[model samples]
Target: MNILITGGSGFLGARLARTLLAQGSLALAGAPAQPIQRVVLVDRVAPPADLAADARVQPLLGDLGEQLAAGALPLADVQAVFHLAAAVSGECEADFDLGMRSNLDATRQLLEGCRRAGHAPVFVFSSSVAVFGDSPEQRLPEVIEDTTLPTPQNSYGIQKFIGEQLVADYTRKGFVQGRNVRLMTVSVRPGRPNGAASSFLSGMLREPLAGERARCPVAPETAVALSSPGNTVRGIIRASTASSTEWGARTAVNLPALTTTVGEMAQALERVAGKEATALIDWEPDAQIAKIITSWPSRFQPKRAQALGLAADESFEAILRDYVRENPQAVKLAVKG
Candidate 1:
């Protein structure tokens, strides 16, 4: 089997690639596991050295939209596709054109490529919780259930929701076996922050533990829905591997979430790396960021995701500890003895 992962060099994309490489083969719909012959990673940047060194990894380095537009992506032979690349919330708000090109145009191109291939490959689209938002006309429920309608309040959210519809329509046409998974914010992400408004969720802990000061854009009481990287990868793979009967409806599956407030997260950081780490977080409110984050539903009843056998983090503290354990070098603060 040949696989394609867009945004293959990103944190989540790279992680998912490494996992697939480790497995060596994939079993789809109860069929025998098929050996992964090649994995084409499509991204503007290169992946980590270790992943690049893998014999199975074929790096397709460039802007995904450009490559797909130029007919450069070799999708004809691809048996599966994992679309994880997109302009994030902050970037979308800052530049609408870039968001349209990167998020909307690129997605349509990818689906078109799959349709032309005639293989009907298993396509997994990484959507976002941003798709659900509070609007003046329609207030969001306290707990977002599977049945709740998505009222995207921002460009990024609206774009993701549009992509979800595209995937669903493409699947209905038998162009691809599409599965859309609405991912919760992944907290405690390793490495430097990017354009995502939710980057602060990781930065608040990552920078602090790295012995540097960090900013908290939202108030302490602001709540969020989160998931760890491990849990997130699991959900992505399950979206593809699950049998057709088990996949249920074609609507997007809201990945499991661990809800917590900003204050509680700070407390968890204190418990993990002691008061020194917590002190490093500077609470500086930003109304723009607050409005965007607050609009997102912070609690969910992702019954579809649960039925797909996805699991959420036990607690925020556990998420923090997992980060500290997995990326020991990224943590400069000594764990309290």
Candidate 2:
């Protein structure tokens, strides 16, 4: 079987690809576990060094929109598709056109191509917690439930919500075997900050630990739901490999997440790398970023995801320790105050 992974070069995408390759096989929606003959990484640029060199990986460069319009995206014989490509929240808010084109239009084009392919491929849409919007006056559930209707407050969130609906409808029509998972904010991201309003969530920990200064965009007390890259990739793989009958409903569910405050994260850093690493984080609050981030429900009653066997991390402290242990050369040794 062949798999197509949009945004396959990204942190989670790349990780998922490697995980799939390591496993050697994937379970197609209606089929038993089969060998993965190829993994087409559909992205705008070349895949990272490690992923590109693999014999099974095919790096197809350029945006999916242009690629599809030009009749370039390989849709036929693609047994599965993991839609992880998207314009991040900060970028979407900055450029509405880019967001609409990347987050909404690109997804539609992909689904349309899948419909045209004639094969009912397993489609996994990577949605976000941003789908749930909360505000000062209009408060959300303390722990967002699976039944809560999406109330997106920003362009990125709205786009993802629309994508979820698109995947569900497409699956309902039997055009594709679709499933969606509302991923939490992924933290301790490997690369530099991108345009996500929540980018600072990882930056505050990633940069400081790397001996570089980072700013905390939100207040110390403001909490955010997050998941580790390992856990996040596991969720994606599980969603992709699940049998159609096993999934039952096509709606997106919130993946389990660890909720922690900025202060707690910084404290975890201090515990791991010392007080000096804590000082590396500048306490500068950005209201615009905070508004968008805070609008996302931080606590989630992700019973559905847990029941599906998706796991959440224990705490922010554990996440930091894992990052440090995994990237020993990139991280600095703990310093005494």
Candidate 3:
């Protein structure tokens, strides 16, 4: 089986590639496991040296939008596709054209490519929790369910929701076997911050562990939904492999989330790495970022995802410890034993 992963150079994208490589095969729920022949990674930048060095990896570097419109992706032979690339929330808000081009236009072109391929490849679109927001028509419920209608309040969310609908329609037409998985904010990401409003969620924890100062754009008490990198990757894979009957409807599946406040995340950091690490996080609020981050619904039932055997992290502390363990070189502060 040949697979394709967009955003292949990113943290989660790279991690997912490593996971698939380690497993050595793609196993659909009802179908026999197929040994991975090659994994074509599509991204603007090349993937990590370790991932790129793998014999099975084929890195296709360039803008996804341009690549797709030119029919550049090796789609004809691809058996599975994980589309994870997008302009994040802050970037989308800052530049509407960037979001539309990268998120909406690129998605449409990719789907069109799949239709032309005529193979009906399993296409997994990575949606976002930002898709759920309060609108004048209806205030958000205390807990968002699988059946809740998405009322996107931001351009990023709007783009993701649109992508989800497109995937649904494409599947309905038998052009592709589409699966839409809505991911929560993945916390404790190892790397410098990106344009995502939720980047601070990972930054605060990551920078502090590195013995560097970090800014908290939202209030410590601000509630947010989070998932570990491991859990998020697993949920994405589950979405692609589940049988049609097991998957139920073609609607977007909300990946499980661990709901917690920024205050609690700080507490968890202290528990894992001691007060010195937590002290590095400065309470510097950016109102625009806070507004966007808070607009997303933090609580979720995710009945559909749970039924698919996906799960959230046990706790934020465990997530912190996992990050430190996985990226030892990134951690300079003394982690509690």
Candidate 4:
């Protein structure tokens, strides 16, 4: 039950590590069983203070590509690997070489490491909705479904799609039990923004709630798919434990999402933190951001995800409520614009 989590310092990765730590402690104490025994966090930088202090947690700081190329990755005795490391859409789209090296090349190296390890760990990949291209003319299907062939229009999406294939092919050869979870846009994320093209999804809510100005890079009417941080973590963990027999032909399953407009999201912020919080948002659409955001699928019929017991925020309002609950100090009811 030794587990390795790459990209363990980023937003989603950090949260996942914390959740695993809590779960791991409970399991070690003879409570209900948890899937992990030893947990390792691998990233370019050390994990956050809280995670770094966990006794069961070990932080491995290094460049994954460099380490993999040098045959220096310490992959022995690892029973599961959560490959969550990758450059985001905005960054990847802006820098082609960096995207290829970080997203695709590094993934290939990791799969090779697993193959060479001789013990096939359960490999769970953190893929994204970016893998899917624009929705077809008819309202883009309600759910993206499991069988859709990826037609990625952006460099980031293309890289992720390639990674999915790598996982599937490696698994087919019995090198590892691979599961790729295509995460929806995670919203109301705690902390500062990263370079993701979808950063605005969390930005519009986070900044305003802090009584600071937040820009809505896309139009208010732009309908986009979303998931909460909690649900996204759950999907990743489920991928680790799900039996290969139950996985079937869908190597990559789209996680459930709540489809809503930017305007609706702002309204939810207003409901939770008052008009002052809503006032912090100023609409200033950037064409590049708009283009990327609009091209992404706005709706998905995640029936496969639902059947797999993956869940999502019931509505944007619930997402906001959860954000406020999770970060009450950073967000207050004060009417400061």
Candidate 5:
């Protein structure tokens, strides 16, 4: 199977590509006749050096929106499309035009390209929980089923919601097999910060454990829904591979996971990394970030995602432990809170 992953250079996209390559090789090697052949990485910037070394991997550098507009993407014979490209919340909120072009227009172009391909490729979109907007008057009824209509509050959320609709309409028209996964804020990301409003969620823990100071842009009590990077990737891949019959809704479904406050997360970090790392976090609230964070839902009961076989971390401590295990260097920085 030929696979294409847009935004393949970004943290989530890069991790997913790596996972696919590793898994695809094992799965293909076991098959006597049918073998996975190629994986394409498309992004404005080049992927990391390690990914480029894989023989089966092909990295394409260019503006996806422009490329799609000019009919430049080579979509023929491609079995699946993982559309992870987008302008993140902070970036989008900072620059409206960039958001529209990257998030909305690019998606439309991609769908059009899929339609023009003449084959129904499995197109999996990485959406976000931001589509929920501020807490509803009734507070989501403790369990948000698959049928809830998206009530987007921000420009980024609005764009993502639009992208989901486009994917659904394209699927409904039999042009593509679409699956959208509404991801929660992924934490313990290993890398420099991107412009996501929720970057602090990971940064507060990641940087401190790296023996560096990390800033908390919100108060300790500020709560948010979260998932580990590993689980988020699993959910994305599941959406791509699952049969349409199994995927009842063309609309996006939230990935089930734990919800915690900044204080709880700090406590988890303290438990795993020790007090020294926790002390590295400086409480300096940014009103802009606070408003955005406040508007997001802190708790979610993703019944459909659970029934669909998606899983998540049981607690913030588990997530922190996984991060430490994945990044052993953090152990040296562990100190008492």
Candidate 6:
């Protein structure tokens, strides 16, 4: 089997590629476990050295359009497609044109490409919690369930919701075997801040660990649903590998997540990294970021995802511990007797 991962150089994409390579085989619906012959990774930037050097990994270093046109996407042999590319929330809200191009148009093209391939490939789309939001009439419930309708409030949310619809319709038309997942705000991502309104969720811990100053855009009391990257990647893989009959009737699932407040996350950080590290965080707020983050529902009843075997983290402390383990050098050890 051959796999194609758009935005293959991203943190998740790269991690997924590494995982697939390590596993060596995939068991598809109603088919025997097939060896992965090739994994084509498409992104504007290059992947890490080890991943790029692997014989199975074929990196197409360019934009999606350019790579697709340049025969980088293995149309005929690609049995699975993980569409992880998109303009994130902050970027999408800031630039409408870029968001449409990256999120909507690119996804349609990928689906069409799969259709044209003459094989109904397993299409896994990475959607977001942004798909649900507050409108003028009523407020979104404290705990969002799968049955609740998506009422997007931002351009990014609208774009993601539309993408979900397209995937559903494409599946309905038998163009592709599609499954989309609404990801929560992935906390404790390792690196500098990006434009995402929820980036601070990670930064509140990530920056402080590295002895760098961090900013908290939202208040300490602000609570939001969060999932660790390990759990998220697990969910992604499961969504793509489930049997056709077991997959839900709908084309999307709201992934399970733990509800945690910013204060709790900070407290966890302090527990692990100490009071000095916690002091690195500044309590300055950004109205734009706060508004966007506040609009998102902090709790969920992702029944479908739970049934499908995807799980959320136990707590923010566990999440922080996982981060510390992954980056031991980033955190200072507690003094011993």
Q: Candidates' lDDT values, in order?
A: 0.93, 0.88, 0.92, 0.83, 0.84, 0.85
Candidate 1, TM-score vs. the true structure?
Answer: 0.98
Model 4 C-alpha lDDT per residue in residues 1-337, reported as the tens digit of each score: 6778899888888998888877763221123455666778889999999988877688888998887778776687777789999999999988999999999999999999999998877888999999877645433444466776677878999999999999999999989889889998999888999899999899888988787898998888998999999989988887776776656663698888888999999888887778888888999989999988888887777776777787777888887787877888987556323
Tens digits of per-residue lDDT, candidate 3, 53-166, equal 999999999999888877889999999999999999999999999999999999999999999999899999999999988766778998999999898999999999999999
Clashing pairs in 5: 274-335, 275-335, 275-336, 275-337, 276-335, 276-336
What are the per-residue Cα lDDT tens digits for candidate 1 across 156-216?
Answer: 9999999999999999999999999999999889999999989999999999999999999
**lDDT comparing candidate 1 with the true structure:** 0.93
After the best TM-score superposition of candidate 4, give how far the Cα of residue 82 lies from its true spot, in angstroms: 0.4
Worst 10 residues of 4 by lDDT: 25-34
lDDT of 2 by residue, 221-302 (tens): 9988999989998888888767766676788978998988888988888988888888899999899998998788888888
lDDT score for candidate 4 against the true structure = 0.83
Clashing pairs in 1: none
lDDT winner among the candidates? 1
What's the number of clashes in each of the models? 0, 0, 0, 6, 6, 0
Query: What ranges in model 3 sit over 4 Å off?
Result: 135-137
The list of candidate 4 runs beyond 4 A from truth reads: 25-35, 135-143, 335-337
- Candidate 6 lDDT, tens digit per residue, 1-337? 9999998998889988989889999876546789999999989999989998999999888788666656567878889999998889899888999999888888888888888888789889999999888756878977899888888888888889999999988888888888888889888888667877788899888888888888998899998899998888888888888776767775578889899889988888888778877899999989999888888898898888888777789888888888888877766545111
TM-score of 6: 0.96
Task: Give TM-scores for every candidate, taking all chains together and pairing residue i with residue i.
Answer: 0.98, 0.97, 0.98, 0.93, 0.93, 0.96
Residues 1-337 of candidate 5: C-alpha lDDT, one tens digit per residue: 8888899988888899889877863211112323457878999898888998889888888999878877777787687889999999999999999999999999989889989998988888889988876655635444455677677778899999999999999999999989988999999888788899999999999898888998999998987889999999988877766666677867787897678899999998888767888889999989999988878777776777887688768899988888888878655684443
User: What's the distance in Å from true for residue 263, model 5?
Assistant: 0.4
